[model samples]
Target: MNLNFITSQISSICSSVWNCIISLDPKVISTIVSIIALAITALTLYANTKNNKKNNFDNLFFHLISLLNKIIISSENNSEKVEITLNDIKKQNKAQLETLKSQKIKEYYEQHKLAVNSRFVELENMYLKIESKKLEKIKKSNNTTDTAVPIRKSEFLSPIDDLDEINTSDRSQVYYSYYQNNTTDEALNYPFDVSDNGIETLLRMTSFKSNPSLAIYNIFNSDGGISQFKANINVLKSEYPQNETIDKINIELSELFLHKNMNIPSEISEDMKKDIVNDILLDNKHGSYFRTVHRILKIILDFSKSEAVLNKYCGILRTQLSERHLIILFYNAQYTDRGKKFKNLVAKMNLWGDNSELDVGANSDAIHFATNNLIWKDKDLKILKEEYVRK
Candidate 1:
C-alpha cells in the first residue's frame, strides 16, 4: 500500500467523483474541484521521491569525503612521529660516541703517566744496586783506610753541578775518541765513555747494545768521585781530529734555535746560559723570587729551539702546547732550591697526571711566539686575560 497504490486509488476516486459531479445539477464547480485535488496529489508524490533521492546522495557524498580526510591525516601524523623517533635515536648514538672518545683519551693518558712513573722507579732501584756493588768492590780491595776522604754519600747524587765547560754540541768528538781508543770488550760494549750515556743506552737498548756504560761512566767521572777515565773527553777529541760531527751538532742546534725564535744572529741564542746560583745557595728562611723568574727564562730559551728533545718525549700532549703550559714545562726543567718542595706538592696533588694544574696566572711573555697581536688584538687580549686569572 505504499505511495504508488494510494496515489492510484485517489486518482481513480477523483475521476469518478468528477463524473458524478458533472451529472448532478449541472455542477461545473464540483467537477473543477475534483480535477484540482487529483493534480495536487500527483505533484506531492513526485516531489517526495525527488527530495528522498537528493538526501540520500548528499549523505553518501559527505561521509566518503570525511573518511578520505581521516586516512590522509592519520598517515601524515605517523610519518611525523616516525621521523621524530629516528632523530632521537641518532642523537643518542652521537652522544654515546662522543662519550666513548673522551674516555679513550683519558685512559691513554693514564696509561702513559703510569709507565713514566714505573720507569723512574726502576731507575732508582738500579742506581741503588750499582752503588751497593761498587762499595763492596772497594771494601774487597782493602783500600778503604788508604782512601783520603771517607765516602759521605753515593757517587751518583740527585743533581751534579753544571759544568760550564761541558757542552752537548761537543759530544761527538768525545764519542769518536772512545770508539777509536777502546777496543776492549768492555769499552766496545759501551757506545760512549759516560755513565749517563750508558744508563740512557741501557734503557733504550732492547736487542742491540749501543752504549752500555755511557750514563754510568759520565756520572762516575762527573761526580768528582772517580779519577779513572777522566781524560776520556780529551782522548775522543784527539781521535776525531776534524771534530766535524761536533761542529755539525752545534750548527744544527744553532740554526734551529735562531729560526724557531725569529730572533737575530741565531748563533748567539744558541749559547743558552742558565744561572744555577739560586739553586746552589738556597736558604731555608726566605725564598728567592728572582731566581724563579730567571729559571723560567732559561726554560723559555731551551724550548724555543725547533728540535727541543723534551717536546718529543711529551707525545700527543705536546700538541696542546699553550703559552701557560710551556711556562710550566719550563718551570719543570729549571734547577731550583724549591724543587723538592714544589715536587712534593705536585706529587700529593697528582700534578704529574690528569688532575695536574698549570699556573695560568704566569706572565704570558711567551705568547708572542704563538699568535700575532696586531690584527687580532682584542681576541688575543681576552684569551690572555682569562688565562692570567686562572692561577
Candidate 2:
C-alpha cells in the first residue's frame, strides 16, 4: 500500500531481471514478470476503488443539488401562481359580496314589494265590497246601526333602502380595502403593531394580573418593561385607527393604552382581517413547497458527515435560492408543525448564511407564498442560527 514499498520492490525486481534479459535466464525472467504484474495490481487496488466511491458520492451530491434547483424554481413559480390565484379569489369574494348587496337584497325587496302591493289591493277590494254590504244594511236598517273603521297609517321601507342608508359607503370602502389593499402589490398586512400573539397576550393580561389598572406593567415587566408596551400600543393606535375597519375590532386601545388601570379587552379579530389572512395561508401549495425544501435539506443534512460538509451543502443551497423562494420557505416553516422540523434543520445547517436575505432586508416586499401576499415587515421573518426566528 505504501508508494515506497511498491516502487522499491519494482526497482529491485527489475534490476535483478536485467541479468535474466542479458544472460537469457528463463526462470528469473518468469519471476520478474510475475513481480511486475503483482506491483501494478497493488497500485491499481490502492487507487481505483476510493476514486470510484468519491465519484459516486459527488454524483449523488449533484443530484440533490439538481432537485434543490427544481424546488427553488418551482417555489418562485408557485408563489407567483399563488398571487394570481388569490387575486382571482379576492375578486370572486368581492363579486359574491356585491351580488349579496345588490342582486339578492334587491330581489328580496322587489318580491316583498310585489307581494305587499297585491295584499293591499286585495284588502282594498274586500273593503269596498264590505262597505257596499254595510251601506245596504244601513239603508235597510234606516241607518240606525253604523260604525266607521279608522285608517291605519304606515309606510313601506325597502331592505335595499335601509342597507344603502347604513352601509353603502362603508361597504364600498371595505370592499376596496379587503380586495385591493390585500393584493400582493400592497402587502397583505393585518392592521397595526398588534401581532396575532400580541393580541392574544394583551387580551390575556387580565388573567395574569388581577388588578386591571397596572395590568400591562405587571404582565409585560419581564419583556422590555412598560415603556415598550406603551410604544407598541401607540404604534397600533397611530398606524391603524379603530375607525378604519367597518366592522370595528373591539379591543379599544384607549381603554388599555391611556387608562392603564383598565383591563386589556381581547384580540382584535372581529374585523375579519385575521380571518382573511388565515384563509389565504391555508393553500396546499404552501405545504407542498415546505415538503420539497424540507426533504431537500434533510437529504443534504443526513448525508453530511461533518459540520463543514453540512455548511458546504447548505451554503450551496442558499446560493441557489432566490428571495421569493426563501420567502415561501420561511412562510411555511413559520406556521406549521412540518415547518418546525424544517426550521430546525435550517437552524442546524445555518442555511440562510450570515448575510441572510432576512438580514439584508430582502423580506421588505410582500411574501409571495403567504396566500397572495401575507404582508410582513423586513423584521418579521428574521431568523439567525445564533438566534431563533423573531415574529
Candidate 3:
C-alpha cells in the first residue's frame, strides 16, 4: 500500500480513539486504548506487507501468461509462413517438371531444358516416323510387297512408356520419384571396358537403329560419364549450335552413330543437372519462439517444487501445436543443433505424455536419420518421437 493509504488507515483508527475520548463514560482507559492502537497498527503493517507480496506474485504470473500467448501466436504465424513457402516451392517444382512456363520458371530453368523436355510428344512421333521409314526401306530394297499385318515393334517408346500407365494426377509424383532415384550412392561405374572399345561405343546400344538420341545421349551422360564424352559433345556442339538442339537432335545423333566411337545411350539424358539451391533454405523464423518456450518452461519448473506446474504448461504447449507444427518440431529437434535444448526440455517434461503418438510421424526425420547413419533397427528418428511417452 502507498503512504496515503497507510495514513488514512492510521487516521481512521485515531478518529475512533477521539470518539472514545468524547464519550461521557470512556469505552476504555487511555493506556488500554494506546496498547490497542499499537496492536492494530502492527496488524495493519503486516497486512500491507502480505498485500505487496501478493501483488508482485500476480504481476509475474500475469506477465508469464501474456508471454505464453505471444509465443503461441509467433509459433502459429511462423508455421503458417513455412507451410505457405513450402507449398509455393512444391508448386514451382511441379510446374517446372510439367514444362509450364512463366517469367519465374523461365528465369530458373535453362531454355534448352524446357525445349528438350517439354516436347516429348514430338520426339516420340519422330521415333515412330523413323521406324515406319526403316520398315518401308527394307520392303522396297527386298522388292517384296506382301507383308500380312506387319507388327511395328516399338519397345523403344522412351517418352510414353512409363507415362502411359500413370494418370495425370500421378505424373508429377512418378516423375519426381524417378528423378530423385537417378543419382546413385557412389560414383559412376563404367560397364565392361570403355578403353578397349571407346567409352561411347561401350555405353551406347546398336539396336536403337531408328534414332540416335540415345547414341548422342549415351556418349555425354552415363551420369556424366568419362571426360572424353563431354569433349566429344563439345566437338559435336560446334556444328550443332546446341548439344540438345531439339530440331535436329536426331540428325546430330545420326551423325554421332556413324563413328565407331559412339552408339545408343544405355542411360537417359547426360545432363540431369537440376538446380534447387534456394529451396534448401527458406526456414522457420521461430528461434525466438522456442527460446520463449524455454523461458516459460523454466518459469513453470521454478514455480513450484514439484513437476505438476511444469507438466501442466507442457500440456499447454502440446495442445497449441498443429500437425504441421508437430512436423516442424520433429524436423528441428531431430536435425538441428539449436533445437536440442528444447527437445531435451520437452522430453524431460514428458510433454506429449500418453499422446506421444501425435509426435510419431512417418519418416518425418528420414533425411536426418539417413545422414547420421542411423539404422532402422535402432528405431531411426522414431525413437525421439517416444521421448515423452508416458510410462
Candidate 4:
C-alpha cells in the first residue's frame, strides 16, 4: 500500500514540473541563455587579450637580448655598429616602457645593465690590447736599425750634434720626470693644436724635446752605412719591381744631379725613382733607415725641385706616423691621470640624459654617442654637464 502511494506522488510531481516548464515564457528563457553565452564570450576575449600582450612583450624582450648577445660576439672591431644596435634596443625598451607598462621588463633591464656595461668595456679593452700589440711590433721593427755601430763624437758631424750633446742629458731627465709626475690636470692643460701637420704638431706637443732630423741622421749613419743602404735598396727593387712608388723613388735617387756626391745614375726611369723611394720608406728591413733619410731629405733637399716627390712621400709617411702617434696617445691617455679625467668626461657625457629625469629616448641616444666617441671636446663636456647631468 505505501509503495503504490509513493509511486503515484512521484508521477504527479514529474507531470507538474513538466507542465510548469511548458507554460513558461519562451522570450524570458531565451534572454537568460543569451546572457550566459555573452558572459562566456566576454571572459574568453579578456583572456586572449591578456595573453596577446604578454606574448608581444616577451617577443620584444628576447629580441633585444639577442641583439645584445650578437653585439658582444661580433662587434669587437666595430664599436660604431655596436652603438647603433644598442641604440635600437634602447629605443625598443623605451617603447615597452611607454606601451606595455610592464614592471617585469624594467626589472629585467636593471639586472642586466651591469652585464651590458661590462660587455662594452670588454670591447674597448680588446681594442686597446690589439693596438698596444701593433705599436709594440712597430717599435721592435725600428729597433732592428740599432744594429748600426755607434759613431764616435769626433766623426764627421753637423752642428745639430753639438746641440744634441748639450741637450741630450737634460732632455732625458725632463722626459723621465714628466713621466713620473704627469697629472690629469697637466694633460688637460697641455695644448694640442690640430691645425698644423699632424706629425710636426704631435712632436712639438710631446713633453720630451726631440729632433726628428737628428733622429733620422743617427739611423742613416748606423753600422753598415750607405753600403748597407744600397743593399737594402737592391733587395726592395727585386722584391717589388713593378711597384710604381718604388720605381719613382729609384729614378729620383739615381739622378746624378740630385746626388752629385754619391754618383747616382742619370738615366733612371720615373718608376724606378718611385720604387727607390718605397724601399727607403716602406721596406721592412731598411724602412726605418729610409724613413730617417727621408726626414733628413725634407730638411736638406731643394724644396722647389723635390716638392712633388716629397709631397707624395710625406703623405704616406704622415699617415703611418699619425697612426703610431695616435696609438701612443691613446695608450698614454689610459694610464695617465689626464687620461682618467678624459675618461670621466666621456662617462659623464655618455650617461642617459638627465639621469634624474628618466627620459629613456634621450638617455639611449647619449649612451650611443658616448660609446661611439670616446674623445670629447670641452664644448661637448660643457653641454653634457649643463644639459644632461642630474643636478
Candidate 5:
C-alpha cells in the first residue's frame, strides 16, 4: 500500500477501536468515527493554504521596501521628487540603473563653446580686411598737388577732429566767455589760462592708425561730448564770478528767438541762457547737441512754445550755413536715427546755388545727411536694412 493510504487506514482503525471501547457497539462506532476523521483532514488542508499565503505576502513586502529606499535616494541625488506605486517600482528601478550621461553632454558643450570663439575671431579678421582695403584706396588717391584733397572726414563726425584744430588760446576765449556769463555771486577762481590747450593736446595724442575702428569707437563712446561740454560750462560758471561775456552770450541766444514767430519771456534769466549754450558748445559739432541748445534757449524765451525744441533748433541751425553743416554730418554719423532730422535741418540751411558739390553734401554735414537719407530712400533701402534694422 502507498504510505499516505496506509497512514489513513491506521487512523481509521485507531478511531474504530476508540469508538468500540466507548459505545460497546462496533458497527455504530465505525460509521461515526470515519466521518470525524474525514472532517479533520479537510481542516488540515485549509490551514496549510493560509500559512503559504502569509509567507508570500511577507516576501513581497520586503522587496517593495528595498525598492522604495533606492528610489528615494535617486531623487535626492538629482534634486527631483518621484513617486511610484509598488506595482511600478520594479520597472522604474530598471530604467534608472541603465545609464550615466550627464558628464559626456557637459564635455560636448565645452567643445561647442570653443568652436564659437574660433568663429568670432574669423569674423573680426574679415572686418580688419575691409579696413585694410579702405586704407589702400586712400593711399592710391594721395597726390602731389599742393592743394591736395584734404582727408574728407568719414560720414561719421568725431568731436576729436574739432579738438585737433582748436588751440588753447581759442578754447580759453570760449572758457572766459563761459565763466563771465555763469558766475555772478561767486568769486572767480580760475582765470582762463592762455597757455593751456587741453583740447588740442588730447586730439593730437589720439591715433586712428593702431586700431582705426577701435579708436573711432572709443571717441564716440567716451564722455558723450555733449554732456561733457555742459559739465565744463558748469565748471566755468563756478570759477568766474561775473563778466560781460555772459550778457553777450545771452543776447546772442535771445536774438535766436526773434527769428522765430516767438516772443522771449522776461523771467528767463541770463545764467539760464548761458547754461543752455554751454551744453550746446560741448558737443560743438553734434547736431543734436546744437539742436538741444537752440531749443532750450527758445523755450526760455517763450515758455508756451516749449514743445518746439526740435523745430526751433533745426530751424536756427539750418539757417546758419558754415562748418556747422560739417558738424551736423559728424553728429549724423554718431546718431544714424537722426536721418529725417538731418534732412529737415539741412534743408532749412541756405544751400549753395550752383555748385553741386555744395548742393547734395556741400561738406561733412551734408554728406552725413545725404548718405543716411539716400540709403533710407524707398528704392535703395534694401542694402542698409540688414545693417540697421531687423525688418
Candidate 6:
C-alpha cells in the first residue's frame, strides 16, 4: 500500500470517530474527558510514590550497614566507645524506620534487626577478648610471692618515742623522687626524726583526715615516691593479716602520699605499660580500684587548700595498690557518704580534658579514672572481683 493512501485512511477514521463524539451532549463529553484525565493522574502519582519509597528504603538499608560497620571497626579494647556506638545504632534504627512507611521497609527493618544483633554479639566477643588479655597481664605482674622480711607487729603498733619532746613545728622535708628520677632500687629511707609510732600516727591521721605534717606526704610527692610507697605498703601488707580495714587505711594513706602526675617507670616494657593502660580501661574490678579511691580523694580535695599535696596523694594511690587491693578498698568505702560524693565528682570531672594535649602531665589520668569509674559500682565491682580477681 502507498504511504499517502494509508495516512488518508487513518485520518478519515479519526475524523469519523471525532464527529460521533462531538455529536453527543456537550455535558457528557466534558464529564468523560474529566474522568480520563483523573485516571491518568492517579496512575502517575502511584508510580512516583512507589519509586520514592523504594529509594528511601535503599538509603536506610545502606545507612544501617554503614553505621554498623563503623561501630565494628572502631571497637577496639574500648568498651565505652563500643557502648556509645551501639546506642547510636539503637537511636538511628528507630529514627530510620519511623521515616519509612511501606511493607517492604518493615520487612527490611526485621532483617536489619537480626543483622544488628549479630554485630552486637561480635562487639561483645571483642570486648571479652580484650578483657581476658588484660587480666592475664595483671596476673603475671602480681604473681610474685610475698617474700620480703616479715614486719614485726610491735614495729607497726609501737608508741611514738619522744612524741612530747619532738619539734613538730620544724618537720624536715624528706625528698622522695623515686619514679621521677628512676630511683626504684634505692632504699626508701625516710629521715627517722619521727619514730615508728609517729609514722603510724600519720598513717592513721591520713585515714581520717588530711595532715600535712605527715612526713610520708613528702615521700609520696617526690619523684619515684610511688615505688617507695609501694615498698612500704608491701611491708605492711605482709606484717598484717588481710584485714579490710587495714587495707583501707593503707590505701587512704597511700593516696595522701603519692603524686598525681607520676609516670610508670621507664624500666617497664612498653608492652607492660600498654597492658596496664588496657587493664585500667577494661578490667572492671581491679582497674576500678583507683576510681573509688579518687572519689574519696575528691572529697578531700574539695576541702584541701594545697593541690600539690592532693595530687601527690592521688599519684601514690594510683600507682602503689594492686588491682586486688584496690577492689577491696573500693568496696569498703563504696557504702559511705563520701563514696557517693566521689561518684558525682567523677562524672563532673570526665568532661574536663582535651584529647589533643601531648603532655601526660597536662592530661591527668585522674580524669580518665573518674570518667570510667562512673560506669560500674559496688555490685559490679564485687562480681568482677569474684570472676576475675579470685580466679
How many clashes in each candidate?
A: 14, 1, 4, 26, 9, 13
**Which regions in candidate 5 have their CA more than 4 angstroms from the true location?**
1-21, 75-391
Q: After superposition, how far is residue 332 of candidate 6 from its true place, in Å?
A: 45
Selected candidate, larger lDDT, 5 vs 6: 6
**lDDT string, candidate 3, 24-79, tens digits:** 35545666778999999999999998789657755775586577566656644465
Give lDDT tens digits, candidate 1, residues 1-391.
5999999999999999878777776466767778899999999989998788657644653454344334323543233432343244335444545455445433433444444334323333444354455445545665524223122133333332222212233233332221121121222222333443322333333211232223222223233312222233333344456656434433332333232332222111111111222322232111222233223223332333332322332222223333333223223223344454443222221112221222123454222223231112333234334432223
In the range 277-318, model 6's lDDT, one tens digit per residue, is 343334333224334345445544554435454444444433
TM-score of each: 0.16, 0.35, 0.33, 0.20, 0.17, 0.19
Clashing pairs in 5: 157-330, 181-246, 183-241, 229-282, 265-301, 318-349, 326-365, 329-365, 358-362
Q: State the weakest 10-residue window (summed lDDT) of model 1.
A: 265-274
Please report the TM-score between candidate 5 and the true structure. 0.17
User: What's model 4's overall lDDT?
Assistant: 0.36
Please, what are the lDDT tens digits per residue for candidate 2 over residues 248-339?
Answer: 22233222233233222222222332344345556545555556667767777666557777767766766666555665565445544446
Q: Candidate 4 regions off by >4 Å?
A: 1-26, 75-391
Q: How accurate is candidate 5 locally (lDDT)?
A: 0.35
- Model 1: lDDT equals 0.35
User: For model 4, what is the alpha-carbon lDDT of residue 106?
Assistant: 36
Number of the candidate with higher TM-score, 3 or 6? 3
Candidate that beats the other on lDDT, 3 or 4, i.e. the better one: 3
lDDT for residue 171 in candidate 1, whole number 0-100? 31
The residue pairs in collision within model 2 are 213-261
> Candidate 3, which segments miss by more than 4 Å at Cα?
1-62, 71-76, 84-283, 305-307, 355-381
CA lDDT of each candidate? 0.35, 0.45, 0.44, 0.36, 0.35, 0.39
Where in model 1 is the C-alpha error above 4 Å? 1-111, 144-391
